[model samples]
Target: MKLLLTSGGITNDSIHAALEDLLGMPVGEADALVVPTAQWGHPMCGPASVRGLVAATPSFRHFTALPWASLGVLELTALPTVGKDRWVPWVEAADVLLVDGGDATYLAHWLRESGLAALLPELHGTVWVGMSAGSMALTPRIGQDFVEWAGAPDDRTLGVVDFSIFPHLGAFPGNSLEHAERWAADLDNPAYALDEQSALTVVDGVVDVVSEGEWHLLRS
Candidate 1:
């Protein structure tokens, strides 16, 4: 799988171009499956927020709002109940997975429970476009500072990637670079602090940054 992890979504021309390069085609020619599962686990998100995201409202323009050949929702929360036979094809058939942001632990838990984590190794060409906690779910740890779901055992996640991520740098009052420095101190691995216009791409184990704004790689 190819990973395009973002603090915000595709917020700039450079990131958008990188996404197309990863897709191996134009965005308008690709099919996408939107994953809003993480939203359900967050206290600040509910039906309305998820609706806004899925519907591609202006507030979520950085994410699901993009134009694609086809767009569908793959709710991870509902995957287990329906059986993998049905859902697997849906995932396999899509060109990209637009994973939205929310609680990383919760999203990680459901990814495992839904068997998607196990299935990842087989998705040779799938592009996983993740934003915020969607991106964090792939890292080793999110740092307890980013944990919002009370049900999470700890800050641990899938660790599909070696590093951690501090998303939305400076987007919120508490997400400044100084705040990211504080968060990185407690983490044992390398990490990146990404601003809204930045993103990181991992393809075949090689990583590269795609940014038009600001980003920092905080080495462990």
Candidate 2:
């Protein structure tokens, strides 16, 4: 399956253009959208968060009607307002799964606790698309030193890919490289340091890097 991964929100013109090129038609064309409610910046309803994002982002705002019509929406939040069974349709019927940015650690824990973690990869035709925390959640490990929105302090991740992704590394607080270096040395595995506007897409086992700035691969 194809996996489209992005660093974070496009804050630059060049980066926005690149993201549009790769994502194609904003998020409106997606077959299914799984937005973690835990990641909403504000305490809004799940559907409201989705609507808010589309409204706030010009690229996504216009496609609101299209996305709602063609795709099923699932809100995986701190707790489900709807039953977990409602998520099956989107998870099972999706050709593309669009994940929004949030807290990686919380997203990971929610997926595991709700039993969706084991079900995601089993999707026969689903193409996974992720951004920021959504991207980080797909990897086996991720740096949580920057924020602790959810889960335990020593939370181990959902082991999807055997690496930690350092999203928005250029914006990491304190010594970014030093912290990354220390994490790499401690984990003894490859770590992805994605700058803002950068992306890493993995499709059918092929990994592609796209960025307007720079991205780094740190290995212990």
Candidate 3:
């Protein structure tokens, strides 16, 4: 699978182009399935936040608002109960998975529990577009600073890539450069700090950063 890990959504032209490159076609020609399971794990997100994301409301214009050939919701929490016969095809048919943000640990749990994580190896053509915690879910760790879910056992995640991420750089209070430095120091591994306009694309085994705004490779 191709990875477009982001702190925010496709908020700039470069990121949008990167998304197209990953899709091998225009976004309008690609079918998309949105994973909103992460939203359920955060205290700041709930019915309203999920609704905004699903509805492509103004606040979420950066994401679901992109013109997709078709759009559908894929609640990971519900996938386990529905059985693979019903949901596997839905996942396989989509060109990309638009994973929204929230709590990485909680999202990791459902991804594994729903069998989605196990299925990733088969989706060689699928592009994974992740935002915030959505992006973090693929990393080895998100660091303690970003843990917002009370139920998470730890900051560890899927580690699909060999690094960590410090998201929302300078966008939110307490998420300034100083905070990212501390976060990266504690991580003691390869890491990046992405502003809203920044994104990291991984294809095969190579990684590239695409940004129109600030981004920092805190650790090599």
Residue 12 displacement (Å), model 1: 0.7
Q: Write the per-residue lDDT of candidate 2 for residues 2-32, one digit (tens) a residue.
A: 5667666444455444444544545445455
lDDT of 3 by residue, 1-220 (tens): 9999999999999999999999999999999999999988999999999999999888988889889999899999998888999999999999999999999999999999999999998999999999999999999999987788898888999989998988899998899999999889988679999999999999997999999999999999
Clashing pairs in 2: none
Judge candidate 1 against the unseen true structure and give its global Cα lDDT, from 0 to 1: 0.93
Better of 1 and 2 by TM-score: 1
Which of candidates 1 and 2 reaches a greater lDDT? 1
Error of 2 at 197 (Å): 1.8
lDDT order of candidates, best first? 3, 1, 2
Report the poorest 10 consecutive residues by lDDT, candidate 1.
60-69
Model 3, residue 15: distance off in Å is 0.4
Please report, in order, the local distance difference test score of every candidate based on alpha carbons. Answer: 0.93, 0.61, 0.93
Report the C-alpha displacement of residue 19, candidate 3, in angstroms.
0.4
TM-score of each: 0.98, 0.72, 0.98
Q: Name every residue pair that clashes in candidate 1.
A: none
Identify the runs in model 1 with alpha carbons over 4 angstroms from their true place. none
